[model samples]
Target chain A: MPHVQNGWYLAAWSDEVGRTLTQRWIAGNPVCFYRLGDGTPIALEDRCPHRKFPLSLGRLDGDVLECNYHGYRFDGTGTCVGVAEQQDKPRAATRRFRLLERDGIIWIWPGDPDRADESQLPDTSWLASPNWTHVKGVLPLKARHLLLVENLLDLSHETFLHPSTIGNAAVAATPIEVTTSGPRVFFQRRMVGVQAPPFYEKSMGLTGLVDRWQDGEFHPPGVFLLNIRLAATGTEEPEGFHMKVLYGMTPSTENECLDFYALARDYAIDDAELTTFQHEQQLSVMGEDVDALEVQELMYATERRRTVESSIRSDLAALRGRRVLQKMLAAEAAEESGGAVPATR
Target chain B: MAPAARTAGDSGQRIGSPGADEEITVDVVRRRSVADDVLELTLVRPTADPLPQWTPGAHVDVLLPTGIVRQYSLCGDPGETGSWRIGVLREPAGRGGSAWLHDHAVEGTELVLRGPRNNFPLVDAERYVFVAGGVGITPVLPMVHAAERAGRPWVLWYGGRRRSSMAFLEELGGYGDRVRPRPEDESGQLDLATVLAEQEPGTLYYCCGPSGLIDAMRSRCQGMPSGSLRVERFSAVPQPAVEEPDGGIEVVCRRSGLTVAVPPGTSILDAVRQAGVDVLSSCTEGICGTCETTVLDGVPEHRDSLLTEDEQEAGDTMMICVSRALGDRLVLDL
Candidate 1:
């Protein structure tokens, strides 16, 4: 492992650990999982310090995980408690990772634990609030997580790759605007005379609009949000619109990701039906993304990276997103060498 | 991290409880379609995870990518740590979470599961009665199995529009004389009165299904002790029609300090977002409980339909989507 910088790598979803020593490989190391009786998720090295046997093969006793093979027990912090034979050994321990749960995802810092910053973790407070009806789903892609991230940053492919869903055949000619910032990238596009899909149409009604049309933004490393508005009939000051946000965090494994999304619509806040309608609509849109992304992953795995030289204005966001990611990666490398990384355009 | 900021009415405070925040990944050793539409997904992990663990009478939320988090019942043998089992019913109304499992998910799909967390777990009782309707059988199905294995006397009143819609019919038969399948009944009605009248002393009644059944059961079980009868509904209660707005209002998001004017034709959430507050929301229908936040000051017309009488009485929370302030201005915890 290339001493991953002190950043958050999604360890597991809040739904993924138990007392049973669940196993997952993140960044590169294998992690054995456990949770306290009160339901706090934790991760420790998979290899037993004693015999190198995978700790995942063990069992859990209350807050402690008991190795099945030799009957060794360890707590949430990865402190060793019992040895099969040498029960009173002074100091036998295993490497433990720092795990934090935020917005339904358990994040781990598999690097220098002291350098872990809880404040740097991504915020997902929307998932818990009742005003939002959100769903957190998973998909194991065939391609590497980095490739998937790249694909997400690239929006020009929608013209060809997702022609049937969000992309329009005629819209390919439209130019896109792209921008880049520190560890963040933005892709923007403006289209005319585009038809609204079910998700958009339904959400428009809830937002107190008649017919709604759209605009979009794709942020780097897996955050996609779109701004859609109501279609104008007579054009009387325009009704309303919304910003739907989708974020994907790929896991320790190269092909898996935890997708977090939220659809903030414009509608009467008190109308229950409108909220449910938005939820159902967002669900369908997510399904569409899953169908496309999973297949995209499969195709990338089967074929070499295709030349992406063709540039459209709308693709600016995707390009900027890529540039930002490259910058972040270079900065990380420079920091490792005790040198400041120069900012790039 | 101010202590006052973490007070009871803190809008940012976690309502999912401390337990609502856990996630566990278990390997699926075996996954089989036990019924036509029902699949028994069994997650097998080393016994290091505790056994006879927590999941009481409700479902645990499973996190799947593509932004899908679904709730499923713990149908497998709850007593065994060898595996955790759940029965998933694919609904046409599914938002890809359950549909993905039905179409794409299979055995060996590593499941990242959260608590067998029961906002609706089973409680101790002298006698137990279970009423399951359609996929609502998820939580009850396992309870019946446990009751049967433990030699506890319980009857399963399972209803479906037709026999085919009801999952685990074969399993229901295994309940023997205790199960009453209501497939033939007109509109598949469940006579909770008849069932409740025959209730034995100290009997605990459990009902899971559509709002109608739950409402019916709740009314019929009125004679039972408070909290003696439990219920789990798949969908939220129906919301009332929104009347034509009399006037526009103003919303102030406490955290972001953004204020927006919500005209009669607009929702408070929309106005707040327009002001760049960027509040997180979903299912703008007010049912999913995703946008619920603390009310700092306002008589929120209390529009959406999810909270119970108790939750509303608590008045510490309000669903921002599809709900609005009764007065001209409202302050929110955001």
Candidate 2:
């Protein structure tokens, strides 16, 4: 939870938090989720204010959650409704976080409720659009959230990390343009005449020398999107297979993250065989990233020795991503020191 | 720090993208003040390749060294293929677009430019009434010359703060009686109402000026013949207050067969990019004529300053960058 970014973060998949007291730790804080009688989702601080007992261990009686420890009951808004043997409930209440559900994902804001603006959230309609098909899963990375963010921003790692699934030698060799417009950082690369990677050739039957492009945009803290396009060489118009690879990296704890990823495409929205192949291939590719990042984090957190690292031209986007994160942290730190913002707790 | 989520995609999604624009690199051969605040620059290709031919009322997007793009009318002779000329007015209140050229554009300076796009084209007419206000005369200058070459009867009403602040007087010196200099210091405002009332059977009015003048002309034009008035605005027409939700409207691209949900924060240009259809775009600011899409149905709230009053009311086409639907559904010919 670097700098505790002040906006909506994906707490779980839309289907992951329903019909039960689902508990999820996001950015170092615990939250419990449940649905009302009408199917509207709700999230509240997991800890009971009385004895600090986890509210997720309680039972949902219609819309109120009855704490298991002292039998205290709370409504969907975390308002203490019943105190077991009393009527007033001793002014006991738990923090209620704002939640918004869209595109098969549920987002929770772990900050000031008045400042939780939904427009700051990313667009992921393709994840659930009838016009596009996707294969998605949640990867529990034993690494910080920024590790996933940097990994996605610097995609040259694909050539080494997942060479068998979606990478090629041309990836590391191709040059990319790194630019920034305010808080947004962009990495764009275009290859006019190159052999299609084996993964792409077999997965989509791409043949012959082709023109390919990789465009990346990073909106710091939680989201990263990569758009890929491929077309035959000498084609006047760029008509080809397109992909929008989306990553919703949510900080679950200080040392771990819940990385939700989905690969949505414009073509083959109705192909069942392709969906199965993509699901398996995605698991394999993401497995490689999770394994690599887990080992990297082991070295980063446990090692007594610190090693110097050198970056090349390909690190331009990653470095800019780091700079924006640092800038946000610095700005937030300044704001906190000035004592203008309300306390999160 | 508040987090913002933007799904990154093709380079065409950039705000500065001269997408599919015919870009030309030319060196400034000459720069001279044509009016009190107007500067004229002559550009020529260093390699002597003939530039693309453009008609009268055409303008080019000058990508200044500072990355600010401003459109200027091509006041030079369209017959000359080796060189191009443009007139720039230093707008004191503008966003430093014209002032950048006025201050930094020098002879021998290399610059990048795009397009000779024409939204205010000069069509054939038996008689032409050319109404130009201040530096708005740049496009009118070429139109009047084209009319003379076509042997058509044309009269130019050139109005400005004063004669010293008006451009192309020397070029109009030979066309005595046909050219009327209505400098405010001497002649008061040109009675556009009188000109509108005297619309001859075959007369077509070509007006290029500030919003006030263009609006006045548009109001007077309704009583006159339809399709008889043509206006070019130097800036965007003021849009009404935005009151849409953040969830966005649904845009269906008929030709591409792609449907996209355009959230309020995302532009229609980027939304179309999500469906893998990159509509050609230049200035996403609603001024440049690129990224214009045909509206099949649904009322489009025209936010662009490019379309004339009647064109907006007609509602056949829209600038996708800054405009959206009046309801939850919009169909576009991508």
Candidate 3:
């Protein structure tokens, strides 16, 4: 019925939250993110309890936030530390979310504090490793998080949606294998002895037929890891180009989501020009996805009722991923209802 | 040019009462003295609804309890939606508006406000130079936060009578050297000439202060570049007169289809309003750009301090309150 709360969502990039208080929305809740004197990042509800003024509008005295409105101050723990000319601070406090900084990203947990588990955080170690060159970008999408999740889980759209860069007719023409292990859904597609896409041609210097393999894994509530390898045809050499593209979709509202994407590569680690070129190419492809998803969202809004839709063989991975999310949501609802056995849709 | 007979019976609308709009009431939840005479008032909507969103450099027109309307910059962060903050400097020798706000406006008082209009908007630049004096620091406060958030280089030269007279000094201290607080007593007068020297190519200058500081910065920035300096003025500056036309000015209201002749000593706004054409106006002086009218076919003698020289030269729009027609017959969009 609503967004699954007991999960990690990307709050912002590591560099975005700094000395000054920054405000962002996660799961339709306003959040204020800032760092302490020792550079420890903190996430708290943006609204002040006294007059509902955003703590971000306030100034920071070390780690304490002073509300610019009436001078109400809050500590890093969201406790009311001081009030102007008043002693004995009231019990007024804002909600403090669990925040973790890892792998150049800040993760926030807006669910029950006791249920927050650090182990559940997505693995993004490649983005921080010096061995791999990475380029990251953030896009605010008008579509729902589920729509973006589906868009990333299915690779067939690449052939049509992204024709210039990563797209080719072979991606849609080739059959894909779908499998699931626990909460992870995997989609594997192989195109052998096919023309190299324009993106690989320019980036990898491939001018002839090549063997391309795409293996994507979806980890809910919204993380997609796509591993791609391209090598010369009829050769199993060790000099093939490999890339790891990671996507993290965090829902800002019911109908809005923030897409955080990082493209990492093991090859061409020293080429800054290649990194810039790949960054622009990735941004262009993502822009195309956003355009398509926004239009799909508009169609869904106009047609309130869902009609009978046809599903192809390539949609198996997306369907499986949706089912996993549904199970998670149902389990969360059941737990909240004191294990009384909630109805599953 | 032929002289047209002046048409009479055209009465202008009274000032302050523009039209009937929804009255949004906000309660003064908190008030505190931040400086010697400056007070910061935090106003919040009584209902649970979020207040109107505003950007940096926007100001709201507050209708004081004494029925006096005054515009104050929303100095609070634009990210805050629940409350709006305004800093007021108590003027002893001037209008009673600021005095009434200082003496009577207190916490828990409810005030009706009209707008959060932004006449001074911050544009994108590689670097920014902010010069504020006395109460003029209100609008520049939020802009500094914006520049910091954007990770752009900026320097604020804030001047007041004394360090104790400046509001938000404690808050500005967090920014460290980026904010230069110049108390007139300790730092002498602001050496705007030296500070503004060696200007960068894409550096934008924003100055809001007394007339002397504004004029000094204006002259210093004359040779820099066009549209490089943006200054907000509290009072209107005297505009040079255009060569007078041979006849009385004829203004044709395109929408209302009324032709009125405005003789010498009469403004085009008064002439148009006299013909039952209602045009919104605030601050009858050309300072407030409220009575700005679009020009269809006319060369306007621009007198308002709102538009830049290039904008006035384009002649697409003119402030009808003070500026008049340069030719005998002119057409107005009305």
Candidate 4:
């Protein structure tokens, strides 16, 4: 999909960046990332010009990124400060990206830096507010970024996929709807006869009745939040049933993704309890997804199918997601080709 | 009239950094019985992948076949272009890294190793005092030899349970009168204070020993100038028991929404791992900064020797291994 060049992309959680230069991919290109003194994110081309060594193989000197191969130092703009071999100075500057920090998330402009917009990043005002706790983690997923984006949008799988936690056995889909707004795609799941799963049973206090279910909306590239509620009075009684899990999926590579999350809910759980609970849940779900999807990727490599088909109604949101992504990718490819016929019709 | 800077301002002056060394398969491995407990492993990399050149204080990160990595000091001369030398002290209570090196690893087995990075180096000093204890002598041995070659006034304070326990007795004797091999020289222990008293004005006191010796020297050498005293601790200092969390507390991993209960004996690190969070950690003993995690919230009982008291008090850093949550629970920025 076409990535917004100037718009913020989560580079890494603050905890992930340290003295060691870590390599991450953005928009299908590898970039080595490091943190500045105040935990600001900096991104540069992963390859060092001295010997084309991976810059992540280097070290961090305060704000300067040092190439591990020959101690070449590059500032935030990615201009080579010092090359160990003095004779190679005439033509040795690496490409630099526009890096920015909002809250604890690091963002990089992988495309045209001239058009990057720092203001477009999702408002993380919840991070500053009281009655909310946050935790940060980094997961190196062996799957395409689009695959992860689609995975989050397809929330119906949770009934079977996460049976013990966020799932329910009797929560058959009564109706599934898809709607779209500018830069946002909404996926709503409605379960008619849903019984409370054991974990949520005690937590929600809806032990007997059909606890109403509605998880809506998937904001493109990567942002998923379900305006969920247990008791469906149909109008405004859906207060305590909703949780906002804003996720940012930054592409690490063509075959890897870095998922950053911020969970804000109206629960009275203490900071420690909320933070640890969400962290543990994310880990379990991520482990399951990583195992299943990496294996799927391996299988996809070997099996080249001529045609793939599915009933559109059963999983309409997933299908629409793929179509929207195809359109974005086509537009990007056309722009790259100077307005030629796009990659796909 | 500009004052000459005592410390090197530029990063260029930080010597003994690792360079581009090709990954080589182990062509040969030789185990030597130096002491009753110590085992020396000599790994020969391919000629094409020439061993990474190292200085005296440098160590290598060895990747064993079992996927465990351990850092060991280069005991043999770093100047040697041949195989690299590392002495492994078989820690009985080790989490299988060193114990595997002592028991199972053998000759002709291929291995991956990261080289010769030196955080502890013998700086330019007029006179050197090398104080070593047990396997801690690995780094000091090379310093003793370098001091002897430079004709720099040096004394070796080697202490162990007995004379046989010392790693490099043969090399220490070459120093002649400079070597004070204190196996049991009587007078109730090799008093490091007595050794520090004879220090001249320009003398540099370098001590690589157990935590007790390093702590004692550090406390006694307080009056010495800042750059005069250099200390390296091989083990941890004895501290109070880590305060346990009350009951089995819930750790709300905010990013994931999964709650895991951390049992009394089990550490937060283990609990995090159990929940399947991928945290990069090393030297679980709290010395190395590999397991250094950012503290998002909660008062971290700083058990690690890596960060200073100020860093701990700032509530931003923590070592995952030995340290525990002081309050009911701690929310780590994983």
Candidate 5:
């Protein structure tokens, strides 16, 4: 499937972009990201307008970026400000994207600049806020972005995929509520008066039945915010433990994606040992996903036409999410083609 | 300006209403291109009844044919109950909301509009200074008229990319010297420093615009009288980073009759969730104002962007998504 082109995607972490040029593919578009002298980030088409040279191979001179091939200097706005040994500055300038930094992440809009509203940026404050100590890492997956999105939206896979860490029978046993709003879909599942899973016992020290809740919100393209909560069973108390997991999946190519993961917690503020434990545990769990997804991608490629798929009740949220993405993609196509919008049922 | 009252429910529904799920549809009676890339839409109720009364800064959510809901200010006079008018700027790079409105929202088209909720209500003041940038002049248009009708001294500093791109120019022509229309093509950027230099004691400063313009006005009005500046933000304010606490704290769930030790590097939210208790939360960041939990007997370290300084000082609730307990143990209502 073709990736959505006209939305904000996580380009890189703030630390990843600096004076040195860095190149990454966003939704199959080659782009280069760099920061100016004052640390304002900029994203431009990786290919230079002149000879289609990758700008990432160029050198930075203050706010001006000089293409290594021809020494063509471009300003922060992607306007070609200088040319090598040329008396007149040419009107040739690379396409510049809207770049925004929020919560320690740099986001780039790959589509229309007129529609690049900063407010449309996904909220990832929990990962960047100081009150929550989080473990952050990037996982380059061989699977498509939509597959990763489906995996994230369907928490039922945890029982089988992450049996040692965040999995339990209750996840499959509990009923899920699938609801949608605009381009976002939400999956909420609550397992009331259920036995505390081993992960909860080891991490939270819960011994008896507990009320566990898992809520995941899916944003178009590929972004998910998961809110997990646990409390003693039969308790009306509002005081409960909670954690937020943020997933930012950026499609680097048709078959590859960069998954930015952040697991933030409200309980433990600054314990290095806990961070290490959680980080190690997550790495092991995510390693399983990475392994499984790679094989799935291979199978998808091999049996491109022979494969058949089926959906269960648990896949409702993922299915809704897919439909929302399809509609958005269709709308974008219609707008580009100047055709009538697709009819709604 | 008072914070826009945010109704939290699923989008495309009347958030606070009970059993009233149907949308209010209105007929687009007239559509005119007021300026380049700007459109003025006049809407009236499908019935003979008058539209809901709205304050000067009120805005209605217009549901477009493209399945996107956009908020547009009520620029028409409040006294005119027969119809409502809104100005929309066609943002070429936007998410298709404005473009759909500019292209498809024409005469005889029916649109669903929700709420004339005023987050930017005009306050009582002896004098006022209004500053607007580009398409942000919509909300201020009605306020200027209200100021004129009340016989209050007021001045408007409106600006856009050029003369052609600025809307409602003919409407402001009646105000003469009181309205300063600064088109960037003819004049440079608005001299905010010069306009705000003279601080009138009772003058309430109202501004609505892009972040750059708002930030300029904020810095310029720093030394002026406190509470004199009011702004309507089209985007969220950047949150300040909080320092992580050093050690784990014990949380006492009063009703659950349980005490959970939140190990270091974990949040109270994570601990509670791990314990199997679900809290209503959305943007797990402090920004969305979701996951706000009441603190029954302990001081909460507030890190959310939704609360004001005074609310933070009160220490009644904290956004669990990114906030933690201050002391070793916290007694919570949850």
Candidate 6:
């Protein structure tokens, strides 16, 4: 199935793109990202539309790109504005994807331009909020974006996959409950009087068997958020630290993804040591994930037989998320083929 | 950003239920009365093929053809992949799962099962002390073999009502003094005081049996080092009622014209049942979603693991077995 074109997918971190032209792949389509002199992020199809020369290989002047092959200049909208050898710049434009830069991330919509809705953007205000201390990073994921989505949605695997970092017996041992609304899927695991993992024990100062909560939500096409709580077991009041973790799976191809992750905390807002510790530790953890997922991607591509995999309780959210995206793709296909009439045979 | 965080808007809610691993149909290759009133069945893959690998403390969820599901600990050798063995004690007063198995299970019987899930895994330790009571020996049997194979210094304290009624005595005889068989008729209650004295640095204690034995071990574990003891209950121990900090709440059973007060130190399930409401409940500790009740109004301060955060936040349905109302009042669909 093709990528969910109408949906907003994260393109690049705001600070990652500046005046320099950078070519990035999205849903198997290469797109160039750069900022105009006004510091506004722009996303345009990398091809020149004429000779299919990658525009990203060209030079940038103020607010426009000059193709390297023929020195053809195009505006931020991928509209060809000037040509060095030809008169009357052909009224041709490479595809321009809509871009939205909000909360330190640039999001792009590659579908029908008129249908882009800003309200549908995920709420990531916490990333820029002063009340939360955060660490963010990205990985060139070598697996289907859905696999990463499934990885985040199925927290049960954490106990096994991330044993040294976040995984612990309690994570997989505790069961999860799934609930969904519309195209969104959510699953929560609450541990009442359970032993805290080492990460929680160190970061949140949660020791012994503590009351904990982990809730995950998946927004169709590629957004995942986890809300975590660690509190003293049987505490009369909600007394503990809270952490908000986010994962963005932007599909670059069927076997490749751009994984964006950010972890924000309500406590230790000014603890630089903790920030550095978490940043380094999270990188190590994600490195392990990428290693496992890359192998999986290889298996997913070359496997010949129909595998006998089964879904259990913890897979409810992952399964539901896949179904929701499937529905979106089905609707798009039906609409695209709606007007075609066939001749009588 | 959410308008009251309602989960039922435009999106239908599906209550999550406990699901098992992929089902595997196996044949009951052999059956025998391991002990008085104790039935032992050996299961193998239908084609007499090797089964999935399992560890010491793993148990299989037997989904009987009658639609009833029961769990039995694997008692056979974990090294043997071609078959698995389980022991079931026939309880006359208990549910009919054991009775059905006792009568219907035979050499040719086919049973569908899920998992060999290990909740009571044997964590690596310098030394091990295994305490088993009667049928609980089923789980401990493999553990004994594992501890021996690992060359870990270990001892097994096996207890039952009578020597004749206890299973695995003949097999355990191979262990010599490593296995201590304490029949109640022969040794009066197994001396827990003597066992407690066996505690030492780097010693890990594992126990499984009736609530009495487990509770006793739990009480004595306080004197031992923290995390040194691990025990698996046959079923979820009844969770004691504790008042939410928000205090007691009034629940209106929408189907029935009755309002029940769930007070501090009282569970909503117990309170409703006490109020003459007959509700079906199983695994009352909240893992099973059998006691899920629809919430027509008011918020539920969810304490159960069966409902997702969105479901709890939606204030739609709740597993009343452990969850309570968040506010002072709740309207339930009964």
Per-residue lDDT over A225-294 for candidate 6, one digit per residue giving the tens place of the 0 to 100 score: 8998888898754568788988878999778999988988998789998888888878988898899899
- Chain B TM-score of candidate 3 stands at 0.69
Residue A52 alpha-carbon offset, candidate 4, angstroms: 1.7
DockQ of each: 0.01, 0.02, 0.00, 0.00, 0.02, 0.01
The TM-scores, one per candidate, come to 0.42, 0.52, 0.49, 0.46, 0.52, 0.51
Model 6 fnat?
Answer: 0.00
Residue B39 of candidate 4: its Cα lDDT? 79
- Once fitted onto the true fold, the runs of candidate 3 whose alpha carbons sit more than 4 angstroms away are A339-345, B1-334
lDDT of 4 by residue, A97-188 (tens): 88766666666767778877654455666665675555556677887777777677766667777777766655435556665443346666
* Candidate 3 lDDT over residue span A251-271, tens digit each: 888888999998999998999
Model 5 segments more than 4 A misplaced:
A85-88, A304-307, A343-345, B1-334
Error of 4 at A153 (Å): 1.5
Candidate 3 backbone collisions, by pair = B10-B274, B11-B274
Q: What TM-score does chain A of model 5 get?
A: 0.94
**Better structure of 5 and 6 per lDDT:** 6
Better of 5 and 6 by TM-score: 5
lDDT scores for all predictions?
Answer: 0.60, 0.76, 0.78, 0.63, 0.76, 0.77
Q: For candidate 4, what is the interface RMSD? A: 26.7
lDDT of 1 by residue, A141-221 (tens): 444555556555555565565544445443465555543223444445554455553455444533222433334444333
The C-alpha stretches of model 2 lying farther than 4 A from their native spots are A1-3, A85-88, A236-238, A339-345, B1-334
Model 3 residue A322 CA deviation (Å) reads: 1.2
Could you give the DockQ of candidate 6?
0.01
Q: Per-residue CA lDDT of candidate 5, range B256-316, in tens?
A: 7767788887878888878877666666666544466877765566655544332343456
Give fnat for candidates 1, 2 and onward, in order: 0.00, 0.00, 0.00, 0.00, 0.00, 0.00
Per-residue CA lDDT of model 1 for B58-83, tens digit only, reads 45567666556566667656667667
Error of 6 at A89 (Å): 1.2
